[model samples]
Structure formats: structure tokens, C-alpha cells
Target: MAEINASDVMKLRKMSGQGMMDCKKALAETNGDLDEAMTLLRKKGLATMAKRADRSASEGKVTVKSSGKDTVLTSLCCETDFVAKNDDFKEVADKVADAALQAAPGSKLAEQEIEGKKVSELITELVSKTGEKTEIGDWAKMSEEENTVVGSYVHFNNKMGALVKIVCENPSEKLQKLADEVCMHIAAVKPMALNKESFDQEVIEKEREIAKEQMKDKPAQIIEKIVEGKINKMISENCLVNQKFVKNEEMTVEEAVKDAGGSKIAAFERVAIG
Candidate 1:
């Protein structure tokens, strides 16, 4: 049997992100062949992932990247908060977001490449290093035309983020400020859609049904009126343009945009990690 030196073990650990003991064992098993040892470590990581496939990975970070008229948001989820906050983990998420932004709007980041390796492979290495189930949760991209402006906000803890694109004839400083405020509102309120028109009819009808069940004791006409009122209120709450502005409660977000300069939200995306 070939002898594995400490330097060889450290080199393998650095390359594979595996534990020192594991790297040493792999090196010994591979007769000090670094490439073969790396393959062995990756296989072990994949096996670990398979064994923990049923576990929940809700804790992670949301990363955002913007360039020109495009903004991308990506979520990298892990099994625990400690791993989520790790420097290596954050570096991986940032790189993934950057790659996703450069690719097509809805392209899968995992299928993309980073540093000559597929992102999925890098994630497997991360799992091997962190000993946790890790995966990408969401990837959203928003693009605007030349006459439009894009704004984004990432919450303090990096767990939530939002991006908004506003279409305006003239992109002035005030219009940009309004767009930023709307993006912040999205990060805070978490609206379901831009407006009532965009909401799913099926969801609205289901809400109406639930409201009818709750008010069954009332008169038929009264029940209809109450159900309509409830559905309208729900729409107002879930629609971004209908929700009251956070900075100025007196006006809705739509009103604020119009007051600022008649800008309208063209698109928006919000990503959160639980």
C-alpha cells in the first residue's frame, strides 16, 4: 500500500471540501491519486444527499444581481442557519446568482457552469463540506426596456428580496425613488401579484367560497354582499398596486407612482427563504 502524506491529505481536502480524515482515507484508497480521490469524495457526497433527500432545507440566503436593465434573484437553501451563514456558502450563492443573471431569464443555474464545473457539481461539493442537504430554491429574473427603470431591495438579513421594473416616459430621480419605494414595499408586504387583474380567478373564487361558508347564517342577498366585500378586501390586500404605500399610508402604491410622475410597474419579483 502507498503512504499518504499530510500535505497530500490537505491538498485533497482543499480540492474536495471534505473532512481531513475523509480526504486521507480517500487518498489512501486511491493510492495517492488526487483526481481519483476527488471522484470518490464526490460520490460520497452524492450518497449523503440521497440518504437525506427527505429532510427539509428551509434556511438559506437570497442573492440579487443587477446589470443594465436586468435584475436576477436566486435562493440557495440549506438545512441549518449556521451553514447558511457560512462564508463559503455565501460565495457559492453569489456566484450562482451571477451566472444565472448572465444566462437566459428562466435558465436553471444548476445546469450552468462556474469555474469550469457545473453548478450542480459545486453544490454537491458544498453538501460534502457542510454535511447538510443543500439545493437551489428559486431563480427569478426581471428585465426592462430602454424607457423603463429597475429597482431592487434586499432585506437586512439576506433572507428576503424584491425587484421592480417601472415603465415611465421620463426616468427622473423622483421616478427612481418611487420605484425603489415600491420595491421596498414588496419586500415588506409580499403582495401576491401586481394588481387584481393579474390574480388567478380560481384562487379568488376559492376565497369567495370560503367567505360564503363563514357567512351562511346571513340572508342570501346579505351573504352575496358580504362575500363580494370580503373578496374585494382580499384583492386589495394581496395586490401590490392596491396596497397602501409604506412610506406614505395615505396613498396606494399606484397612486404614489402616479403622483411621483405617472410611472407604472411593468414587472416585479419577490423571493424569500423560510
Candidate 2:
């Protein structure tokens, strides 16, 4: 059998996102065959992650930026809170987000430019300089009518961020204040959907299973009714528009939007530490 070294295990861990000991074990099991070890690790990770899908990812930084009606938001995550707080990490996060705003969704980051440098090159340099693994966690952009202005709230700390695009109906201090409040709420409340109707099919289906399990003792018809009601309740609570307003708690976010009159929230983006 080939000798499995520390460097070999480190390489496998980074490539497969598996635990260090697992990587070492996989290498030993595969007789130090890197490719075979990677495959084993990936398969194992798939199984492990599936079982722990509910694990909360709470270590990440939110970044938001806006240009007119065009807005973008992103999340950058690391292995620990200590790394997330690193100044170098934050700088790289900002640069990556800037590069993302310049590119459209589903495009290659290698093709994007930041400060006249390709993002791919920047990533390489940053990794070497920081001595830490860095990857772009998420990227999203929103745009409205060209004439309208985009507003952003990056929050008190780098912990959370938001971008709000407004459509001209009219711009007033009141409207801006309302928009700011909405952004703050996004960071604090973390709604999973924009409206009840907008919940993803997969999310609904998963919730349906949970509801059925919870109401299993009831009559079949009653169980289904209960499941449907549970799904609706989840939508109202998890969706932004239907959620109770974070600021007031008495009104739904939708009500606040309607009260804003002519001004409309064309789009919004929010992210928090994982």
C-alpha cells in the first residue's frame, strides 16, 4: 500500500468537504488512491448530509449592494466564526460580491472582472494570502424599471445585509424610512419566502410529510385537512409578505407595503451569517 501522508489527507478533506479523520480513513481504505478516496468521501458525505439536513448553518456574512433599480445580495461562509470575523476574509467577501454584481446569474465567475482583475485570479491570490479556504457561498441580483433607484442596508455589523429595489410611484423620506425598516426586518426575521403562494414545491412537500406524521392518529380525511392547514400556516409565517411585521408584530409585512401607497417594493435580497 502507498503511504498516506498528511498533505494527501488535507487535499482530500478540502476537495470533498469531509472531516479530516474521514479523509484519512478513506485514503487508507483506498490504499492511498486519491481518486478512489475522493469518491468514497463524496458518497459518504451525501449520506451524512442527507441525514443531517436540518443542521443550522449559522456561520456566514451577508453582503448587499445596489445600483439604481439593480440590486445584488450575497452570502459568504467559512468553517468558523473566527474566520468570518477576519478582516482579510471580509475584504475578499466584498470583492467577490462586487464581481458578482457585474455578472449575471448562472455566469462564470472566472469571466467576471473586479478592479480590472479576473475574480478567479483574485480568489487564488486571496487563498494564498489568507492561508484559509475561501469560496463564494451565494449570489443573487434583483432589478426593476431602469429609472427607479436601488437602496441597500448592510446592517449595524457585517452579520446581515439586504438590498431593496423600489419602483417609482414616488420617493419620499417616509418611503425611504419604510424601506430601511423592511430591510432591517429581513435581517432580523429571516423569512424563507416572499409570499405564501411563492413557497417552493419541495418545501411544501417536505412540510406535508411532517404534518402527516404529526396528525397520523386522526381520520385520513381529517389528517389531510390538518396537513393543508399546517402548510398554509407555515407559508404565512415563513413568507415575507404574509409574515407578521418584524417592527410592529401586529401587522403583516404586506399590510405595511400597502400602507406605503404608490411606492412598491420591486424586489429585495437578504442574507445573514449562515
Candidate maximizing TM-score: 1
Clashing residue pairs, candidate 1? none
* Reference-based TM-score of each model: 0.94, 0.69
Candidate 1: tens digits of C-alpha lDDT, residues 64-145: 8887777888999999999999988998998888788778977788899878988999988888788889999877888878
Candidate 1, residue 31: how far the Cα is off, in Å:
1.1
Number of backbone collisions per candidate? 0, 1
lDDT of 2 at 83: 65
Identify the runs in model 2 with alpha carbons over 4 angstroms from their true place.
1-60, 80-87, 144-149, 166-168, 262-264
lDDT of candidates 1 onward, in order: 0.88, 0.70
Q: Write the per-residue lDDT of candidate 2 for residues 119-200, one digit (tens) a residue.
A: 7555554443333445565667776554353556767667687766655566666656777787788777888877655678
